[model samples]
Target: MTTNPERTIPPTTAGERAMLESWLDFHRETLARKCVGLDDKRLREASAPPSALTLLGLVRHMAEVERHWFRRVLAGEQEAGRIYYDEADKDGDFRVSESDTWEEAHATWQAEIARARENAAGRSLDDLSAGGHRDIESFNLRWIYVHMIEEYARHNGHADLIRERIDGATGF
Candidate 1:
């Protein structure tokens, strides 16, 4: 299937909102563009031992990662369900059920990213919330930005290897 091109930064002066948006768009685009052309088998194929680092799994996991931080933590929405929380201890996102298809994984991820983009649209950098009164003192917004980059970077690394294993494709 044809994929949309990478998301671009909105033209603006260098500011905190722009920087946050750039990072968010960068990671989402990285995953979508990097996983292009992978077939169902390749998307679900396990990369190594212990855990399945399939591109499909990464997509699902990244969607959860985005929702966990953006909706649950930052927005203080306590009702958001954990991704695959219904599967007990097993990594259901990575397990790839008999009915699980590449299209399902891709659609789920894209929907989550779209939700996150909507969430980002209504906020500014200076708007601050302390998240909670627990021992952690960092700002809520900072955690959101950092976690997005960290989750994307880790899974994108998995995508790189998974792509290479699929057909010798490589690059960021």
Candidate 2:
């Protein structure tokens, strides 16, 4: 097992909000850590046939996810040009091109994360999203936090396998 030094485990004991934030941050760092030492070509390598999943793709997808949940849904703001995918190309973020660079993907994901934190700051956990997302309307901040944690946890598992496959690395 290869341990990534970037992430610190969430504290075992904390308040509700603090715990949620910590775990979410940990999972985010976990994903980034998984891709830490890879080249762009390796980051864009698919896991297997028929599945376009890649580390770079996951980073882009997470950037899209973070923007959607925080900026559009929670903050009730338009993300404008930075949106990574759309209905016309639903899998756009997951389809990494030769042009895609790890530098750009990492920066975008990190930027979205910073924006997510900014959008959530000063808001109570009970606060509702400023708008609806898909078939759902009005997600409380707490739910968004939990949902993000779950999303990252699930994707982090994929990242684990991908990283392992890429460079025989595991653990963070």
- On a 0 to 1 TM-score scale, where does candidate 1 land against the true structure? 0.81
Query: Looking at model 2, which ten-residue stretch has the lowest summed lDDT?
Result: 1-10
C-alpha lDDT score of every prediction, in listed order: 0.70, 0.87
Which segments of candidate 1 are over 4 A away from where they belong? Answer: 7-13, 128-138
For every model shown, what is its TM-score relative to the native structure?
0.81, 0.93
Model 1, residue pairs in steric clash: none
Candidate 2, residue 170: lDDT: 85
For model 1, residues 1-172, the per-residue Cα lDDT tens digits are 4565566654567676676678767778888877777677767887877666777777877877777666665665657777653547556655675566768777777777777776656666544542432455335565577668787878788788877887887875
lDDT of 2 by residue, 84-105 (tens): 6777988899999999998888
List candidate 2 segments past 4 Å from native: 1-5, 79-82
User: How well does candidate 1 score on lDDT at residue 166?
Assistant: 77
Clashing pairs in 2: none
Among all candidates shown, the one with the greatest TM-score: 2
